[model samples]
Target: MTDNIWTYLMVGITFAIYLGIAIWSRAGSTKDFYVAGGGVSPLANGMATAADWMSAASFLSMAGLISFSGFIGSQYLMGWTGGYVLLALLLAPYLRKFGKFTVPDFIGERYYSQTARVIAVFCALFISFTYVVGQMKGVGVAFARFLEVKFEVGVGIGIVIVLFYTVLGGMKGITYTQVAQYCVLIFAYLVPAIFLSLFATGNPIPQLGLGGQVTDGAWLLDKLDTIHTDLGFKAYTSADVNTVDMFFVTAALMLGTAGLPHVIVRFFTVPRVKDARLSAGYALVFIAILYTTAPAISVFAKTNLISALQDKEYADVPQWFTNWEHTGLLGFEDKNNDGKIQYYNDKNPDMDAVAASNGWKGNELTIDQDIIVLANPEISQLPAWVIALVVAGGLAAALSTAAGLLLVISTSISHDLLKKWLKPNISEKKELLAARLAITVAVIVGGIAGINPPGFVAEVVAFAFGLAAASFFPAIVLGIFSTRVNKEGALAGMLVGIVFTATYILCFSVFKMGGPEDYWFGISPKGIGTLGMIFNLVVTLVVTYLTPAPPVKVQEMVESIRYPKGAGAAQEH
Candidate 1:
C-alpha cells in the first residue's frame, strides 16, 4: 500500500480501538469518573502510567532535541528519567496510601483548609494546560504531515477526538485506552529504531548500535562529531552549556516529574498502596525501554538526515522532503540562488570563512526539530508501513497524555473547585456533568494553544515541568514529610513558587524582556524553577516555624501515611 493508505489504515485502526475502549469503559459515576472506581490491577495501571508519563515530548521531541543539542541535551533524558524514579520512590506510595482522588484533595484535607485546596487546584490547572500545549502541537504535527491537513485543522481534530474519549469515559476510559496506547507507541518507536540501527551499524539492538561502528568502520559517535564539526557546529559528543544551568534544569525536571498531578493521580486508580508501588516499578521498566533507546535514535536520525540532505540538489530531494514541505514544517530557500541546499550553523563565527569560500549565502534549509522523529523513517528509506506506524505511535503518545492532562484540568474544576469548595452538597450526577463540561472547554483552549505554542515541544513541556516543580513539589513533599507545615506555610510557599517561576518564564520567553545577560544569577527561564523551588522550601520552612503547627489530627494523618502497616485500610476525610 502507499504511505497515505497505510497511514489512514493504521491511524484509523488505532483511533477505532481507543474509541471502542472508551465506549466499553465509560464511567457511570463520580468515583468511576475520577479514579476508575479505584480497583485497577497493578499491571494494567502500570502500563497506563507509562503511557501517561510518556507524552509527545518523550516520543516525538526528546530525540530531536538530543540530535541538535548533542551532549547538553542529555539533561532532558537524565532529569526526566531520574524524576520518575523520584516519583516512584518518594511520592507514589504515600499519596496512594493517603487515598485521595487528586493532589488537591490530598493537600486540602492534609492542610485542613479549603483555601489550600483552591491553591493546589489553580496550580494543577496551570501546569496541565501548559503541558497539554505540547501534546496538542505534537498531534498537529503528526496530522499535518500524514493526514495532509493544516496544523490548526489537525489540532482541532485532535481536540475533538480527545474530548470524546476523555469526556465520555473520564479516568476509567483513559486508563484502559492508555494501556493500548503504550503497546502502539512502544512498537512504533522500536520498529524504526531497530531498522535504522541495522542499516547504520549492522546491529539489531539500538542501544548497542549506538556504540557500534558505522559501515565506514568509525565509531558512530565519532562519525557524528565529525559531521557536526564539518558543518560548523559543536561536536555532537561535547557539552557547551554552563554546568550550573544544566544542573538546575535537570533538577527542575526531576522535581517536576514527581510533582505532576496527572501522573500522581494514576496511583489513585489502583486498589492498594502496595499496588501503587508495584505499578510504579512496572512503569519504570516500560518507560526505560523507550528512554534508553532515545539517544541511539537521536544519533541515527541526525546522521541520516545530514547525510541525505546536506548540499543536495533541491530538485532532486527525496519525496519525504517534499511531503514534509507541504506541511510547512520543512523548507529550503535558494538564498545564494544556488539550486543546492546549505544546512549548517550559520551563526558560528568560524563558519564565516567556510560559507564565503563555498559561496553559501546562509543556512538555507529550515527544519523544525520536532519533525526529526516523524521524518526519520522516510529519510532512512524505511517501508511505507513503518512510516505510517510511526504516525500512529506519535498520535498515541500525544493523545494519551492529552487525555490525562485534560482529565486533571476537569477534575480540578469539578472535583476540587465545585464539589469540595464551592458546593459541598452537589449531586454526584451534577458533578459528573460539570467535569465533562470543564474538559470540553479545556480541550478547545488547549487546541488553540497547540496551534500557537510559545516554543518547541520539549521546551514548552520543560516550562510546564518547571511550573510543577516550583509550585507543587515543595507543597507535596512538605505535606507528606513535615507535620509542622501548616496551611499558611503550604499556601504561601505554593503561591510564591508558581508566581515567581511564571513571571520569569513570561519575561524571558513570552515578553522578550531581555537577553541572557539579564538573567537572574545567570539562570535561564527554563532552569529558574529550581531557584523558585528553593524559595518555596525556605518560605515553607520559615512560615511553619513562625506560625502554629498543623492540628493534631493532621499531624497524625501525616504519620499514618508514612508507615506501611495499615496502608490497606481506608482513611476517612
Candidate 2:
C-alpha cells in the first residue's frame, strides 16, 4: 500500500497541534510544571487522565490479548476499567481535596515526617520507571513500523518529542497535548473496528457485532467457540479462569490504578474536589468506549484470521503474508512436509496426533496473535490513510504515557530529592533548571531501555502494577481517612509492603523459581503481591493502634485539607 497523502496530512496536523499546545501552555514555575497550576477544567482533566491511563498497553496490547485469550482476556478488561470505578469511589475525591503537588507530598505532610515522603517517592519512581519502559518500547515499535526506521532511531525520536514538551510544559503542556492525543488514538482505534464490524456482521458497534450473528446468521461468538474447540483451543465465551487469581488480578489492578502517581496526580489538576470526583466518572466513560469495543474487535480479528488462512497453502500465500513474516510477526514451518499451515493446540495430544498424520508438526502457523488488532485494517483491506492513522494513534498513545511518567520521575528527582533534601535554599530558577536536566537524563535512560527492554513489556507492566498496589495504595488510603494513623505505622507499612512485594516478584518472575511446582502456598509471585497488600493493611492498622496518634497539629492540617475555605490554602502558583 502506498503511503496515503491524507494520512500524512492528518499526522502532520496532529503534530502541529501538539507542538502548538506545548508552546502556548509552557510551564514557568514549579507548580505549573508539576500540577498545571491546578486550573484545568473537569472535562478536560478527564480527557487528559484518560489519555494518561490508556498507554500503549491499552491501545496496542489489550485487544491483541483479547484476540488470543478470548473470554479469559476479560480479566484485563474488568481489571483495567474497574480500576477507574475504584478510584472514583475510594481515592480521587479525597486525594484532590488534599491538594498537593505530588503524591509524596501528601504522604510527607500527612505523616508529619520526611521518612514517609521519601518512601512514597521511591515507590512512585519504581512504578513509573517500570511502566515507562513499556511505553518507550511501544514508541519504538510504532515508529519503526510506520516510518520504516531502525528501532533505536525510532526510540530516540520518541524520546526527543516527549522531552521537548514535557520539559517545557510539564503537566500543563501534557494535559492539553494529551487531550489531542486522546482524540487521535480513539478515532484511530474506533474507525477500523467500526469498519470491520460493519463489514463482518452488519453492525457498527463491536459489542453488538460480537454477539450478533455473522453473514451466515450464526452468532459470532458461538461460531468462534466452535472453531476454537475444533482446534483444541479454549471456547471463546467459556474460558477457564482461576477464580482466586482472577479476583487478585482484578483487585490489584484497581488498587494500582488508584495508587498510580501519574494518574492520581491528574486529579489535583482540577479546580475543586467535586470536579475531581465527577471527572473520574467521565474518564471511565471515555475509557469504556474503547474497552467495550475491544472484545468485539478481538473476536472479529480472530475469526477473520482463521477464515483467511484456513484454506491458503504455504506456496500460494500473498505478498502481505510475506511482508508481515519479514517483521517476525508471522511465521510458519511445514514440519511434516504437508506444505499446509496447521494451527491448533500444540500441546493437545489428540490434536498433535491428527496434525502429525496430516504431515504437520504441532501448530506451525506462528503468527503472533497480538498483531491482529493493529493489522486489522490492512488485513481487511482498509484505506492506506486508515493504516497511517493506526500508526499515528499508536504513537500518540505511547508518547502521551511516556510524557506523563517522565514528568513524575523528573519531579521526584528535582523537587522532592534536591530542593527538599539536599539543598533547601535553592532558588526557583535553579530548581526549574534542575527539573529540565532531570527530565533530559530520564528521557535518555528511557530511550536506551526502549531500545533494549530487559523483559516482556506486558510482564513488566504487570509487575509495576503489583508493586504500586502493594506499596502506595495502603499508605495513601490510610493517610487521608485514618486520622489516628501515625508516621511510624505509615513508614513501616510502606517498607514492609515494598520489600515483600519486590521479593515475591523477584523470586518467581526474575529468578524463575516459583512456578506451580515451587509456588509458596499456591500463591505465585504475580498474584502474591495482592497478598502483600493485605499484609500492608494489617501491619499499618496494628502498628498505628500500638503507636501514639498523629500530633494535634497534623490532625488539624488533615481536617483543613478535608474541608476547603481558607486563604492559607496551598496555591499552585
Candidate 3:
C-alpha cells in the first residue's frame, strides 16, 4: 500500500464535514422530516435527487459491467439515463402537483380505498428493502478496503453514521448531505476516468478517448472490436442481443426511475409543480455527466485489460495480479504448460484450437466484472489519492442511495401504514419516533442482506425498476390523467400486474418455470421485467374498464391534486 497520510486525512475531513452537516440540518417537524418543509430550491433538490438516484451500482459497478458485456452493456447506460426522460415526460411534474408526503398516500386516496394504500405501502417497502440491500453491501466493500476494517465492522460503522443523521434531520438532513455526496461521488468517478483516458489514449475526454485513435494509429473501438472478434467474442461496439427485449428493458428502466417512491419523494421537496419539472431536467443533466463518460470508461478498461494480458507470463505480472489472485479475482492455469495465460472466449469453437495449441485453459482470467471500474485507477497508475477518492466515491454512492431508500421505507411504515392505517390518532412525536425505529431496523436487515447479495448487484437492481414500472407507474399515471379509475380497478391492476410481472421474472430467472429450453421468446431476466410492465398496463386498463367508475368524491380529489395550491393544506391535515 502507498504510505499516503494526506489521502487518509482528506478522507477523514470529508467524513467529519458530512457528520457536521447532518447534525446541523436535523429536521424539527414532520414536515421537516418528510419534505424539508417544502422549501428546497429546484437546483438544490435536483442535485440532491441526482445523488440519491446514482447509487454505488452506478458509480462503481456499471462501467465494469459495460467493460465485460461490451456492446450488450450499453443497454444499462441507455436504459438508466433514458429512464430520466420518461420521468420528466410522464411522471414528475404531475406527482409534484399532487403534493402528498408519500407514494402510498396518493395510491390510497386515488384508488379511494385503504386497501390500495396498504398494498402501495407494501410495494414501497419491498422495493426499498431489495434495493437498499445492494447499497449497504457496497458500503461494506468500500469501507473494508479503504478503512482497513472487516466488512461487517465497516457495515456497522456505516449503519451508525446513517442512523444518526437520518433520524435527526429526516429529509432535511438527508437532502443537504446528499448535495455534498453528489459532489464527492462525481469528483471521485470522473477524476480516475480522466486520468485513465489520458494515460492510455493521450486523450483528455473519456467519451472521445473511448473511440479515439491510439499511438498505433488504430481507433480504440476498432482495436477492441478486432480483438474480441479474433478471440471468438462479439464486437465491442455491436452486440446480437434481441431488439424487443432491449426496447422493453430500456422502457421499463425509464418508467421505473420515474415511478420509484424515494426518487418521487424528492420532487415533493420543491415548492411547486414547475419546480418539479425544472428539477427533473437538472437531475438528468447531472446524471448524464457520469452516464456519458461511463461507456467510454468501459471501452477503455476492456481494451487495456486484454492488451495487458495478451502474452504476459504469470510470474512477470505486476503485484496487482498476485493481490487480486489472493482475492480469487484473477486465476491462471497453463493447460499446455506454455506458462502464459491466454484470454479468449471459451465458448467460441473457432478459438478452441488456439486454446489447445497455446496451452490456454479456457481463458482463466476470472476477475468479476464488478471489480473492473474500481480497478481502473490502479491499472492506469493514478496516484494513491485518486484511488483513495475512488473509495470515498463508492461509499458516497452507496450511502446516499441507502439513506434515500431507508427514508422511503420509514415513511411508508410510520406515515402511510401505521399513522394512516393502524393508529390514525398517533401523535406527531410518536410517528417520528416510529420512523426512526423503522429506519434502524431497515438498516440492520439491509446490512445482513448485503453480506449475501443475490445475483450481481446491477442485474438484481433491474428487478426493482421492473416492479415499479408494472405496479406504480400505471397507477400514478392513470390516477393523474383519468379520474374515473376506481379502487377495484387499481387494486386488481396492481395485484394482477405484479403477479404477472413477478411470474415472468421468476419464470426466466429462478424457477425455470418457462421450461428447460424455452424462454418466452428468449426474454432473459435482464429484459423480462419490461414485458412485465406491459402486462401490468394491459391488466390495469382492462380491469378499470370492467369495474364501476370511482365515486364522484374520489374524482373530485383527483381534480384537486391537479392544482398545487389547495391540495397541500388538506394533505397536511
Candidate 4:
C-alpha cells in the first residue's frame, strides 16, 4: 500500500477504538461527566493520569528541545517528574479527602467566598488554554504529513476528532481512551529508540547505548561534542545557561506540575485517598519510562542528523528532507553560490573565516526543534508502518491531554460558575448539558489559539505550568496546611500572584520592553513564576496575621482534610 493509505488505515483503527469506548461509556449524569462517579480503580487511573500528563509536548517537542539544548534540558526531565512526588505527598491525598468535584469547588468552600472560586476558574482557564495551544501544535505536525494539508488545517481536523470523543464521553470515556493512549505512545516511542540504539552502539537499550562506544571505538558523547563544537553550537553535554536562571526555571516547572488543574483533578478520580497516593506512584513510573529514554534519543538523533545532512550537496538531500520541508518545519535556501548545503551556526563570529573559505553564505538549513521526534523514524530509515504508528501516537498524546484540559474547563464553568452562581437550582441533567456545551466552547477557543501559537509546543506548556504554580499552588497548599489563612487572605494572594507573573510575561514577551537584563535578579520570564509563588506565600501569611481568623467550622474542615484517617470517597461537594 501507499504511505498515505497505510497512515489512514492505522489512524482509523485507533480512532475507531476511541469512539467505541466513548459511546459505551457515555456519561449518564453530571457526576459521571465531572469525575466518572469517583470510582475509578487506582491502576486504571494511574495509566490515564500518565496519558493526561504526557501531552503533545512530552511526546514530541520535549526530546527535540533536549537534543538542541543538551544537558541543560535535564531541567525538564527533573522538573516535570519530580513535581509528582510533591503532588502525592503534599497535595493529592488532602484534595481527595476534601471530596470536591473541581479544584475551584475546593477553593470556593475552603476560602468561604464565591470571589475566590471565580479567581480559581480564571486561573484554570488561562493555564488550560496555554496548554491546549501546545496540543494543537502536535496535531498540526502529525496530521499535516499524513493528510498532505497545511499544519493549521490539520489542527482544525484534530479539533473535530477531539470534540467528538470529548463531548460524547466526558471523564469516563477519556479515562479508558487515555489508558489505551499511554500504551500506544509508549510503544511508538520505544521501537525507534531501540532500533537506533542498536544501529549506533550495538546496544538495544537506549539508556545504556547513549553512553557506550559506537562502531568507531570513540565514546558517543565525545564524538558528539567534537562535531557540535566544529559547527559552532554548544557541546551536547555542556551547561551554558546562568545558574540562577536554570534553578528558578526548573523549580517553577516542578511546583507547577503539582498545581495544574488537569493533573490534580486526576487524583480526584481514584477510589480513595490511599488509591490517590498509590496511583501517583504508578503514574510517575509510567512517565519515567519515557523520561529516561528521551535524552538518549536526543543524543542519538542529533548525531545521526548531523552525520547524514551536514556538508552534503543540496541535490543529494534525503527524501525525508523533502517530506519535512513540505510541512514547513525544515527550510533550506542556497544562500551561497556553492551547490552544497552548509548547516552550521552562522551566528558564531568564529565561523566568518570558515564561511569565506568555503564560499558559504550562511546556515542553509532551518529546522524547528519540535520536528525532531516526528522526523526521527524517517531520519533513521524505519519502515512505513513504524512511521504511521508514530503519527498515531502523536495524535494520541495531543488528543488525550486535550480531553483532560477540556474537562477542567467544563467543570470550572458548569459546576463553579453556572450551578454555583447563575442557577443554583439546576438539575444534574441540566448540569451535564451545560458541561457538554462548555466543552464545545472550550475546544473552539483552544483550536483558535493553536492556529497562532505564542511559541513552540514545549515552551507554551512550560509557561502554562508556571502560571499554575504561581496562581494556584500557594493557595491550595496553604489552605490544606493552615487554618489561619482566611478567605480575604487567599483571594488577595491569588490576585497578586497572577498579576505579578502575567505582568512580567507581558513585559518581556508581548511588549518587548523589558529584556532579560530588566528581569529581577537575573530571573527570566520562564522562572518568574517562582518569584510569584514566593510573593503569594508572603502576602498570604502577612494578610492572615492582620485579619480576623477563619470561623471554627472552616478551621475544623482544614484539619479534616489534612488527616488520613476515615478518608471518604470523592463526592460532588
Candidates' lDDT values, in order?
Answer: 0.92, 0.80, 0.79, 0.87
- TM-score (C-alpha) between model 4 and the true structure: 0.98
Model with the higher TM-score, candidate 1 or 4: 1
Q: Indicate which candidate wins on lDDT.
A: 1
Error of 3 at 358 (Å): 1.9
Clash-forming residue pairs, model 2 = none
Alpha-carbon runs more than 4 Å astray in model 4: none
Q: Estimate each model's TM-score.
A: 0.99, 0.94, 0.93, 0.98
**Residues 402-451, model 1: lDDT tens digits:** 99999999999998999888998999889999999999999899899889
lDDT of 3 by residue, 148-205 (tens): 5566676777777777777778998899999999999899889988987887689999
Tens-place lDDT per residue, model 4, 1-573, is 766677898899988998999999988877788788788999999999999999999999999999888887888888888887888778988999898877888999999999999999998888888888888878888888768777888888988998999998889889989998999899989888898899999999999998999999999999999999999887878877788988888988998988999988888787788888999889989999998999988998899898888888888889888888887878889898677778888889988888878887788989888888878888888888888888888889889999999989988888999999778999888888898998898888888888777678888888888888889998999999999999888888888888898888778865778777788999877788888889988898898889999999999999988865767666764
Query: What 10-residue stretch in candidate 4 is worst by lDDT?
Result: 564-573
Ranked by lDDT from best down, the candidates are: 1, 4, 2, 3
Better of 1 and 2 by TM-score: 1
TM-score of 2: 0.94
Error of 1 at 400 (Å): 0.2
